[model samples]
Target: MKRKNILLGAFALLLVLGFGSCQKSDLPLDGTVSKERIAALQSNLKKALHDTTQGWVMMVQGLNANVRTAMPVLLKFDTLTGDVTTRTLFSKDKQSSKFVLSASTGVPLLSFSTFSYISQTYTAANTAITDFFFKVLDVTADSITIQPFRKGNIYQSEGGAIMKLFRASSDKMKWALDLLNAPGNTGNIFTQTSLFGRDLEVRLKASFATDSIRSRTGFYSWGGSLNVVKSNTPITRTYPTLNPIVIEFYTTFPIPANAVPLDVNTVVGDGLIYWQPTTALTPADYFLNGPNATINFLKTDYLLIKSMTANSVEVYAVDASGNVCITGRIGD
Candidate 1:
């Protein structure tokens, strides 16, 4: 009886040990994530965005000729606990662009662009800030399909560039993931501008209205041919005619309280310009003289001259070399 009891106890102990081993095997083991790995991933993502030779450089180069003409002033990046932020400043307009990313997923989450430019002595302010929430819709060992929740606003110029960057970067990302084995073609042309610019151009089509010319308006009208000169010689000449009139009118009447002056310099320098309203003027109160010509104004205590009686006006012309010459200002 004693030997049988001993045998039973030994069998029970063996069964307990076997069950414990099975339970331990069924539990999942922790896959540890190290700080060093996270840091390396962040670095790689930053390099991909700002890489001049291979990455976003191509996308940035495709910005409108005017925007690209201005050089960048500063480009900086900062690493946080699990994210990275990059900032850039442009030289011409002191414009800035910022980008933020997640370290773990190597995904971009936010982007912002801001700038102020002077046109015809008036200041124009522009800002665009966008947020992107990247959700992994599908993932495999070699590829990922992500749905981006994009929310933000942008000025016309920077908006176009941002759209282009997104499209180009998406294509590049796929190529990078494929180890460059994929073809270099993105279905869309890299040279095309955003749809927004195209829509704006269409909306601003030329129109005409006829009414009796108001007297004592204190209007100053200037018109000149736009001639592209290379090596001090005219390459292309765009003549000004009476059909499409470009004029600048100044008035101190009870203009709307929300009137804002357009930046004349930015308009003439760049093809398009935008302005915000102050108590003096609103953007809506301003009108373009011609479809091709952009108009902007400055705030002055008073209009220098109130009225003109002549059928025609005479104005001084400054040549490209800064030589002042007298030109006959013809009226329509």
Candidate 2:
């Protein structure tokens, strides 16, 4: 009778221990989601949208057209297991986009686009263009505010005239710099002379337009003397002092209107030229201009030529010269 009792007691103890283990296993391991994490996720998403490179593509396909003009849209986060379950937001175009971000890397894995138009002007000149800026504004245990930088015109041009003036001066300086072969001397007489002459023309036009306006019968007209004294300033340009080893090449590529020419030394040290033939030649075909040379086609990171005609091939690369670096043809 005692043995039976002992066996029964041991069995009951085992069963109780197993039940307790199972209950503990079923409980949440990391506990409930915290408010701080939600806030971080929101801020990170905003920053990513704002920090994209120029020419980045945004896909908009399915939202109402008027929604594209709205300011900032709020971010909604769903949290599970201390990670963001999903992020939903609308853009200025009132079209909704969804992002799935990993909590660990903060990198978005998948992005969806809704029909919307981007209202902010991204192609504006002479100003930093930021489409979006987001940061975690505030966080609570259950909610967060993803602060968005939206619809800002902080550096907007004062007027069209001002914008024109800015562009003109910028162009004049750029031309002068290019003429000098991007020399380092800031006080070159030729550059200064050219700049002065250009500036004078710009100023004269501005002044004439400003002073000549007259209102006759509620209509504006120019009433000042049409004849004006012309300045006899001599036009001259001096070449920039160049380093001995710097090589310069003239090409048809248009320089950015606002770009300041770099000194020759700065370009040569970091520059390499890629030379690709205009014609498509197979591995067995010898390069017409280059002796005993054929192209070794590489499919790796090398640039791909789309079509090869008798005279030219269409090619592109990450850099300007990537197409020029190939030396071998396809077979040999």
Candidate 3:
């Protein structure tokens, strides 16, 4: 009788294990729920977009590489008409594009199907950011959490980028345009910025005084241009693209072999630079190979003007986990 009881208990355990394995295989992508729950979520997201009369202030924290420190982009969505309007600091007026909420992949996706250059400033098929589809992670009455939606309508295995849209004040657009070209601004790129466990007093190289004055650095090599450059002398480099916007710094610091080097000239200068691009010729992230070894490298991989204001400039760095490691900002 004892042996029969033991045999029956073993069979029951096997059945339980088999059922649990089957349940795992049946789970859907994107961690989505059943068909009915998905429908409910879709309806809720629509309401979230439509109920906010004042619109949203949107900002993207890039996917461990791109860093956008500009003022958040303003977005107003007309859910009834499917029109999404945008207001940029650089624009005098707002622009509109079509948007859709799709759920064919067992997950909700907010897709921006149209293209606008002015809009592309923040959302280009971008190195650090994109103005394309966003996989909706969570949504509420006043905020929506999102990630850039790569193709396949699936959750990306590559860690996702997080963006948030908060309620905007009615007069937020007042901070637009004309403010971008405000006067009485000295052209200094960065003051003292420390990131990746290093300090970069990003002042114009006093030793390279003759090479000083103004430097035109391109944040991107394509249609996008970073226009904060004006040198006392004309740039003599002969490159096809206006990329690797160079910022030279010379201290008794040495370059790290594994550190990311920024050299628009293709020759890494003594001062830490952030412009040596990969084959795509685009600035690559991952400034360090192992621990913040840049203490010795003295190289900086980024020095673009804050995309938000020309009155002040900032040079900052972000870590892989989307933390602001450190920041240095300057006005004038």
Candidate 4:
């Protein structure tokens, strides 16, 4: 009887152990985010926007290098009226429009629901254009980071100047249409860049539209030594225009205008020429033009500038893996 009791007790203990092991380690306590919790978050976001005085200041980078450079924009949100007052370097007057906050796949989106100056503008081809919804990526005390988002999370990656916003203060707002118009104040001519320790020529036009091709010759921010004369022989571009081609993947999504006004470089050291084409052509001597003047081929390059002053700008050009491919100065 004692032996039988010992075996039964051991089996019972085994059963207890098995049941304890099966008790589902409590599923990691990531915390169950209920519907109420999401609503609370959305409400808090709106509160932050409404509490600000000067609203928000953002240097908005447009859809696929449209502005020739990042354009400063101000958005003053009135949550009570579901309205947002918008301003930009492109327009002097404040334009009011409707805005809505909603959630998609657990992420909140701030969308311009009506025509606003920042959203609605004249295209380079002189047609109507609109900049659509923004995904609220993060919110801090003084700033908000947003991503230009299309429906279904397409091209949903975060990048460029449009990603950040600062609560605009009286002291921080320092841009106007007139301030951007003066070329001597807006940008400096940068003609010398380096790649692989070799210096390259790069002269920026006072205005790409009216200048002769020779005046704007030399290489792009992403070029190499000699790299050959940036143009092939027998080519000439008397008048040039930076054209913005639409990325067709954004179906049903409102896109920004393809307008690069003559004085679009509001910031001195921040311009990326993703797609630029002259009226005719420039120097006639490059086998690989990256993407600047190439026809139909799509390879992207940018001008990463820093430490800009009245005389010089530290130019940076990176390779595919983010390694510094080109480094030098373009200054007096």
Q: Number of clashes in model 4?
A: 7
- Per-residue error for 273 in candidate 1, Å, reads 6.4
TM-score of 3: 0.46
Per-residue lDDT tens digits for candidate 3, residues 1-332, read 99998999999999998887675466576654557676877888888787776677665332223332233456778888999887533232456788888875555878876754222433222233443667677777667787665522245463245776666643433332223233332232232222212333332222212342222222212123333221110110211122223332222234444444332321121111233222222233211221022222222333323332433345443332223343444233
- Candidate 2 matches the true fold with a TM-score of 0.22
Query: Model 2: how far is 155 from its true place, Å?
Result: 49
lDDT of each: 0.25, 0.23, 0.43, 0.43
Q: After superposition, which runs of candidate 4 have C-alpha atoms over 4 Å from their true positions? A: 1-8, 20-32, 62-68, 117-131, 151-162, 170-332
* lDDT digits (tens) for residues 43-102 of candidate 2: 654444333221112111111221111111122223222211111011011123333433
Compute the lDDT for candidate 3. 0.43
Write the candidate numbers in order of decreasing lDDT. Answer: 4, 3, 1, 2
RMSD of each predicted structure: 18.4, 25.1, 12.2, 14.7
lDDT of candidate 1 over 166-247, digit per residue (tens): 2123443343223222223221111111211111100110111122112111222223522211111100011111011112
Q: lDDT tens string, model 4, 1-332?
A: 99999999999999999998886676545646645565766777787789887788765432343223344567889999999988643323456789999886466788888855434331111111223567676777777776655322236443222466776664444442223222332322332233212222233332213431111112233335222222211011101111222111111112235522111111112232233332222331222232233212111223445345544545543322223434445444
Q: Which residue pairs show backbone clashes in model 4?
A: 191-202, 231-283, 231-284, 231-285, 232-284, 232-285, 233-284
Candidate 3: regions farther than 4 A off: 1-33, 64-71, 89-93, 117-131, 151-159, 170-201, 204-332
Angstrom error at residue 293, model 1: 11
